[model samples]
Target chain A: MANAATTIDSPSEATIRERIARHAGAARVPDRFKIIADTSDFFRVDYNDVVVLGERAFWIKGYEKEGRFGLDDELKYWVRRAIDLADGTTTILKLVFHEQFETRIGEVAITCFRSPKKEARILDLVADHPNFMHGRWSRDTAGNIIRILEYIPGRRYDEIIAEYGAGHEEYFHRFFPRVLAEYIELVQAIKFLHDHGEKHGDIRRDHIIRDSERQVNRWIDFDYTYRHGESMFGFDLQGLGNILIFLAGRGDVLVPDLYRDQRQLFDTLWGEDLNISYKNRVANLKKIFPYIPDSLNRVLLHFSRGAELYYETTDQMLEDLATAQAALALHTGRGS
Target chain B: MSTQTFGDLSRRDVERHLLVAVDESENSKRTVMYLADFFGGLKDVFITLLTIIPEPSEDFFPTEAARAKWLRDRRAVMEQAMAGYREILRAVGLEDHQIESRIVIRPCASIGAAILEEQEKRRCCIVVVGRRGISHSEEFVFGSTSNHILHHAKNSAVLVVE
Candidate 1:
């Protein structure tokens, strides 16, 4: 069976369409296409399926597995990988999916939604810029906006951190400086977007990929948008804090679990040091890791429940981050 | 022992509630004019003018006094506009009891979502908004309030007046 499929030439669009109709319900039909997932019948592309948009057709290779690209699980239903038949290059295909929901931070209620159209706009603005995913979009027969992004091969930043296999104390001294340098670059990239009047609505540890070829962090996914006009970039600011906490703490330090298992570390932390949105997660790392300088710990406090002030803009944050970096240089003589 | 049925039409059953979301823009005045020309002098229809003032969090400003002063100034301006809108409806033969004005001061992420919440709370059957003449590029990137309402408002008929 493998030999027979391998011998066959790349099928035409018409032939591929017929195979899709023939194997409508069947799963794993040899070399034929199978609809691996369907979302409310709005989008139904799957492994081995051919997606035609405009004059170009892309042959589906497989669905991008969750955590592989740090792709959010919620977005998995609409995102897949394919081989661009024209150029024989790989691409990431993002299908149109509508999702809107609300969340609350203290007294403020925020409405967040998925916007493929906005992402397409952002791609155009950052087409030539490094440290951003490159892509273009087109409408399908159903009027659904389909985005084809050139694939960036690399491990997610979180995946790299997890593979480091070092204790927090060792990682802090040996590798934390390198992470901070990369984070500074990431901040500049975000600043570029802000300068262009765009926001990377979804910023997380997994969304940043350490490109194996370029050897730099490249941010992916800018489709999430939240309604907060008072501070237009408020959501992205909070996202930056979350990444800092994740990177500094070496991962999430669940306070409740710590209290139950390791009472000593839990006893050191105050209730006010917890994240404003996630009450059980610790935000102030200095209480546990005394090695963390006061300069840097002060920045993390802005995202905590006991915060007296909040970051208003990226420029403001970069100023404080510079001070923190200077203090780190004094101690370790590494990242000055 | 008493069975008296006289067409079974109560005041509540005959009333049609409309929630019109407005701002200080000139387009909002046109919306009011359109409403007056279409549904004016209708005894059974009730209109509620809603103006949402998104109050930023205390931390958003440099000082508490700054935040307080900003809120006070914003409320004053919006209250004046709401009063004017209320008068426009009253002039069209909508009785004092039939016209209601609401100025909400709260931390709202989306004005469109906030308006829909009030619509659901007041059990309004129709929602009215003024088109802002937003360009396609601007609407594609920033999203417009009217578009958000037209897409997300549930169980209510939405009307957008230019």
Candidate 2:
């Protein structure tokens, strides 16, 4: 009879299985548990840490990316330091391979990393700059690493809008203030990075970590950070403008008149005569966001006016943002 | 050039005199050659060669005698390189009176600071430098000296030749 295990259709699958088997043999897991499933992306092993080592154990994430990139040792040193400084109630360990596993011990989540080098730097930065991020790490059986982040535990603003539907003008009134606050905080974090001579190149919604309990939202992921002194002010502002458009829901509503006003101001101050491509995109803004009210769109466009003056300095931008926020509050009677 | 007319020139106009800055690397030779070609006809151009020597740290301390010997060896090397640069200038048909060369020895840690100090003292208009590859620290992913000078120098336009 032919061996059923070796009868996999794909060569890649077979290779992955072989690699996982080798790792499983070397892995320090209980003998009662075995390698239940394996793949090129990850390996799922069944093992009881309690039975083998007299401790509650969980699954180990065997990563292939770690094997390819190898360990960045310098980064690991920093990661270790950040973890030590973080809340130590949960057990978090750094593993040899490049993977992170997170387990919940009671109420607190334990986060670990296989290669702590890059992620550790990120964690340190987030901890030092609370306005920037909220991240943590933990380790797993078989020496795999895991990162247990506080899941962004709230609904997206757009989702909330859709769920409430029509006949919910009161709901809109209740949520608008909170939405504006979130936008202001996000902009503040961006300004902070700029003031510190750094550029947070990636500023997507996914990268924005929100903690509703603390009424705080922080920017995360510093892999794309560039020293502000080295990059052109024009380029940085361009990125900031693009991020604003992205956050405004990519044309789901009317292109805010505030966006247009800001673009004009940006052009005048920065001398950034955006090419035909950008002009065309901006001209057709109404098509992109049909749902947004004309008044709200006008406010959005006004919000961009400060962006034009971003080239002066981050401090100036922050001051402008504060003024704009005040004006917006007065107009809306939000009394912020 | 009339003295009264010279005074009438704006700061920008006076600072337009191109100053080519070079290191002691092999690539600096190419940089010098390229700069010479670029500013060949410019009348008020000045070329200054600066070499940053790493100061003896605790990890690299030498005996008194060894330090003296090392200084002598470095001076000899610098003298030879200056001679080669003079020949390069001559071969490129640069007027002997128009071209000026100086070899500066400064601490490596403050190379950027030294360059800025020299530029201010010399009233340099534009700075021509060689582009270096990745460094060990990864602090400045691009050429460190060029990037530093570009950021810190208020009056100079930096031209980095790869």
Candidate 3:
């Protein structure tokens, strides 16, 4: 296997030696990438680095550039301060920078460290999401000062979802259930955010990570998250429905049989005519899954009702899913 | 947890000691200086710089053989970092007898936890690290590792130098 360290350009043997010597000198090198200090027991310097103090661990990130503009420094500061206050156990630090001339876009290098208590929390979360992949970050002192952390690994969920296509039952069988579960989870998570007076303005597959092993899912990239009042219900509902429709199938294919049922339920609650769009979505689902079973279609149709009629609150939909799961269990002798 | 107390001793009374950590950034020189200040000198301090080799991702390449080759290439880079750390120590006047260093390859998510585990097993008294400077906004959005260590260094004192 290729060594993980080999891919990146770290300090070289001679460079490290030179750095040590330079640090010992009174006149310091002004290069953006030069080392600043080297002593008997510790080493300190800048390397496109950022420090995040978490409740559980301290995360140090290293980047390749100096600084950037257009980035929300204020937001970053607030988030760091908030994490420091929310809990005292885990911390995250990131290193990012843009080119000297091109200050609009920048690159990111992140490191995460946790205390024992926070470490346990991370371990448990990772364990639950076995499919989730990450990079290794830590401190190493064999000869010189070094810290390492793992970067996020694997293909993004959106890429995988796009590859599979929305209509393929095989794809749906493998990922749809998880996607549905994620939608529900997102609703709940968003509710939590809302209760806390936060609004995740941007909610999409790119923001959510999926782990296949322990069936774990998480939302990230809160850069666009915001705070809005309860009056934002219309926005939230529109976004939710759009995401569901997008995930279920976009064009003329068979909408998941379960979702068809959900549409009817949604209509009942909202007292709105969604027949045109519903029919189009069902057609799209059929095209996606040509051989979908009639019985499954019935179930999907039933489930669609929840989307149309009963989903005034996120909980209402969750409760309906639970009831449906129990009924399905009695019918098929299988429980999720 | 059982706390083992050792009688207070002068700096001269303490024997040889080693500090192990990784240089995630290219600024090992700065990190080294911070360590020197933290521990008083490089005379009795043996620093070991190490890096972990992560498992190759499935998308590393198109074929298994290609992926394997890519991994091999990556390993070479990690080895180079290890060598660099060794050279840095030598330039600072740390003899082989005083400092022993190597790079380790392992697949794990939490590198900080691993370092602490090794420190406890080795019974080290201090851990010296370099601090990453991040904007206040980013820090609040994402937590930091150095901050975590600052709060939880129960057995060993963590000296975070910028």
Candidate 4:
């Protein structure tokens, strides 16, 4: 039983609304944007909103916030999507939203933060690089960055692997070599960033979009950064390893999933064969799939329990991968 | 001063100089103790206590004042720590002139690289550092500063005191 005129509301609803309004004021593009309508949930505007940047007007269409389920309220509110009214092309609009977090890899704890300006700087640096998403940015009256990134059309490599139909054996023999080659190219692109004293910060399977039209694997999302220290690119390097495991295993092949699907293959795996960081997951794929060469398995072992030495740079990884490629070539020749 | 040539060390006219890189960690204190045990009361040995304070990137802080405050606080802490280290070396019979204390505040990507650069500039025969005590997994992912110094230091003998 409540008062007749009293509208029920959460305790923090008013606070959230106030905070959002403050952020929205800072992110205002002034004469460039017109708010057509408002979304019921997070985003600032609804469908078909008009945003004028310089001489171009983009119509807000759809959004692609991948971590919608996990993202905090503050983060979800800043990201947006729009389509170019003149060219009929889509673009991702990222507004400034600051967040900092501490993460550890083994014993080393690192402080990472979100920096929209840094991402804009990276975009400018790699503007012509084919393997990276292209974007241009401008600052608002409050000095908050507003980036308009070209929405590259393609499916994520993770989804591509998840929907792949061929069995592991067939895929390994028929297409794994090509996958390896493409991965090398991807690593080279990362090396380019490293050479320029920059880090991708976030490197995941889904962040890699395979643009079939461009025939390139383009990396997106560069807003994350960490305090530079002994392990400057540790997060990115680890992320690359995870992606390799996913692609090589033909998707995430968890221990329980493998046991349920193929008891024989699961039986072949030992505790040491699993990833030390992720003990429940298989790392030594050569144990289950014997066709996986020892050289490549050794590289994978860098992320597993059997590792003697880990890669310090992309150059070392590339060198080891080249050796694996040579071995694969010899094996293929023998099979022919 | 007596010019003594240690085993396999090239003959030199000047006194032997050692560059000891230190921070405010317990491991650094241990390294200082180890140096006192070995090189203490050796009047000919010159020790340069070097501490490199990496200036925080501008993007790391919300404002210029915050970044400046961080740098100032870091410099103050390191300066005090360096003074204590200097006192310990001085008590061990090393003259005040023989021990040179340097605190570098600059944008550095790698502390190991900065140490190596200082070693090259100062022409120190030996570079000493406390082992960072990183686990195998940590070493694999983040890399070891001591390991980097060990492999990359040129024209200077590296001593990683554990």
Candidate 5:
């Protein structure tokens, strides 16, 4: 398996050690507890002090970038703030995890850690994708494991809504095509994970981070990530449906809401079920506002409609999303 | 009740901690069931059921007995409201220790703020609440609790169960 520590192909054992050596100075983190950056989202990680999540403390033997991203034996939430000494920028650090079991064996409080092996395997399994967060781990003198992960400097989905979604129906309308593409990338990101024989156990809007600057999406918190087996990938698909609705609806305001009512837009993804026929799905969405592009509605139905507009695989879902994206461009009269 | 507190839930190994804030509305009761079905499958989850009640009027009683009765009555009603949540959690296979229900009393009665406060204290990853709890007119005048949490709960994911 390729190393989860390095993004490119295998960084030799020496290479990994050298990269660690280089980053050690970059992530020197002046004061263990201090603000390293002052961006708009500074408070997002700054307000809260370094909370180890579950445990009171865990030690890190090497630089955070060198620590493997894996499960620990003790079950506790630990939040670490780290700075990139090279760029002097800070990113919040959290680990992809496993279930830690605590047992009472005689009088001793025996706590066993989750092996880092599974996380390493999963990272190697999905190594081809740059969107998945890279993880490394290090242990302190006490043997407490410190797992490290990629920290993207981007706003969460909710923050986007709060900043522009409050009363901006026109903004969403003008950017409908762009929104469709972003959603498409989101679907593709998941497809990559699913195609790689893994499933993101938990998929929420917050987990689908938007790197606006890079114009890309990254999935985080692999706590629920596991190898795909017999599942149809329905859970995450439906979750994407839910996310689309929330974004389109701009969140439910009891006073007739802003997004849906303002533009006469339909809540196509809301309460969608497999039983709903594809034609009816399109019809229902159109009834709300006739201008809703048929192509866009069709794509929505593919996920919502069980048998008729159904997609068997996410790869298929990705292909049709491309078609939908092209059609959306024409509908909104925008270039792809 | 096992009296298992959510405080002891392992933060490191926590699959997810979901906080559902409900009221006496049937929709609120349904919220618990919805949560049970949607997020119930996770093996290592902690569900905190929270309810907010109006603070008793200081002038409601001229005598100590009246105050006692008032407090007792409020507790009884809140406990009765929470019973359905307990039943649903049990029915869904959550261990006794995994379920926690708390009733918070605030005289000002800002249910939304209280819910956010509880979320902060517990650090719940998700906050699920019922959308039908307040009337449309009330929402227009007072703003809905769900909206307040939706806009303010930056770190915690907000789910409005309709």
Candidate 6:
């Protein structure tokens, strides 16, 4: 209860709608629609109220993938916000459309771990982990499988970064703590999955959500999480590291970097150095803003670049996150 | 010489059929005017003004009085909405015989599909419709009826007025 004053309220209905509309526009096709059933009795465009079935709302999320292969072509991967459709609800409907990919920049492996059953399994493996959304599964009449799970209400982590990370001296400091807390929580999330012998295949920034109330960050989408014969949670950890830099506005550093070249500072994130893989290194948060406190910077730096001293297990990462969170919080015990 | 179904027209006088969908919206009104301006004088065109009334909101119950009132209100609304369309078509040179109208009350399902089906069955060469030209994001959640017909009406050439 100590962090009461610091707990940010969720945006108003109007604001949420405006934001969802803007965010929904990111998808390539005209997709952000609710499928109206014979239940035409009720049709509302209010974003806060999702399409409800059997007294609960199911939110349909589609992240746009543009030209990952074809020139100017686009596709959206649909994920039904289940499990948490309601506070007590646990099953969700997940839709997937088969698509092809071709790209010279990277090996285009489409539909590798796209089984609904696999996502259900991953959720079960990480259930009660506080960070991963959990659910059960059943198929609809159309044979489209429904993965029921908790529906976490929040914007994507990257959406927030894109929305608020203006890097203005005052606003940056004001919003950075919560954003940092989200990263730390996500680290714990991945660590929790890893310790239990599971991997969250896709850990992209868009795959993570900062709950509407701004209380916690939750990792989402196991569609491409699994890698064949790939051991060690390092991949997920590295992803979390990259997301940290991304959430800090691509570490753009519009101002001159007094101590280090801006290009060198972001080498890990943008693949400036040929040697470092996208997941291997992450830019330091300090690169974005020199005013970023050293304690927070050190944690992100170690997580991003340091190998051995870095978090090998989630507990190790969790311990440091606790410290960083405590040092940065206006008050202890983030009970919103 | 033989007149088709409704009687009193010659077979050799077969008219090119046009199906135009109308709703309560101003865009639909624009569509009516557009059809009149573009196809009014086409050699022999039979124009069908189609108005699809989606089943009333969920709360309209099965009670006799409620059902009767719903029916009465829907007919009144449809007639009122189509009055302007009928006048515009007639004003543009279509006689009572050349121009006709029908209102469909959907028990359930899509207005777009109904328009396409009617256009195909009626051998309507061209389907005139109103395009709200809504944003993809809005169309994503709430589909644009005109946009759907334009893409899915394989048998008919759709003319959408924005």
Interface RMSD for each of the candidates: 15.6, 15.6, 18.4, 2.3, 23.4, 20.4
Model 1 pairs whose backbones collide: none
Interface RMSD of 5: 23.4
Per-residue lDDT of model 1, residues A228-265, tens digit only: 65356767887788888888788887887888998998
Whole-model lDDT per candidate: 0.74, 0.43, 0.41, 0.74, 0.54, 0.54
What 10-residue stretch in candidate 5 chain B is worst by lDDT?
B134-143
* TM-score, model 4 to reference: 0.82
DockQ, every prediction: 0.03, 0.07, 0.01, 0.43, 0.01, 0.01
Poorest lDDT segment (10 consecutive residues) of candidate 1 chain A: A1-10
Name the runs in model 3 displaced over 4 angstroms. A1-184, A187-336, B1-16, B36-43, B59-61, B136-143
Our model 1 lands, by Cα RMSD against the true structure, at: 16.0
Which CAPRI tier for candidate 4? Answer: acceptable
Task: Encode model 6's per-residue lDDT on B1-162: one tens digit a residue.
Answer: 213433333442345677888877888888888878877755466778888776543222323476568778978988988877788888887677767788888643456877887876677778888877653222322345776686688766788788
lDDT (Cα, tens digit) per residue for candidate 4, span A1-336: 001111222223233333333434435433343432122223556554554443344566565567422352333456678765446566787767777888765345668888876798899988999999998885533455667788888887777766554698877766677788888888999989988888888787778998878978889888888875566776677778878887788986789988899889898887777775566778888877788889988888877766777676788888998998778767654321
| Lowest-sum lDDT 10-residue window in model 6 chain B | B134-143
Model 4, residue A100: distance off in Å is: 1.8
- State chain A's TM-score for model 1: 0.83
Cα lDDT tens digits for candidate 5, A117-206: 344455555556656665554332222334445566677765576555335355345665666677777778778776764556556667
Residue A223 lDDT (model 3) = 25
- Per model, state how many residue pairs clash: 0, 28, 139, 0, 22, 22
| lDDT tens per residue, model 3, A177-240 | 5555556666676566545433444454555565544455555433232221112332343345
Report clash pairs, candidate 4. Answer: none
Q: Locate the minimum summed-lDDT window of 10 residues in model 3 chain A.
A: A97-106
Give the alpha carbon lDDT tens digit for every residue of B1-162 in model 1.
112122223432345778999887789988998999898888777788999988754433434697799889988888888888888888988777777888898776678889999988777889999998853323322347897798789988999998
Residue A171 error, candidate 1, Å:
1.0
Ranking by lDDT: 1, 4, 6, 5, 2, 3
The stretch of ten residues in a row with the least summed lDDT in candidate 3 chain B is B1-10
Runs in model 4 lying further than 4 Å from the true structure: A1-63, A68-75, A85-88, A105-108, A256-272, A330-336, B1-13
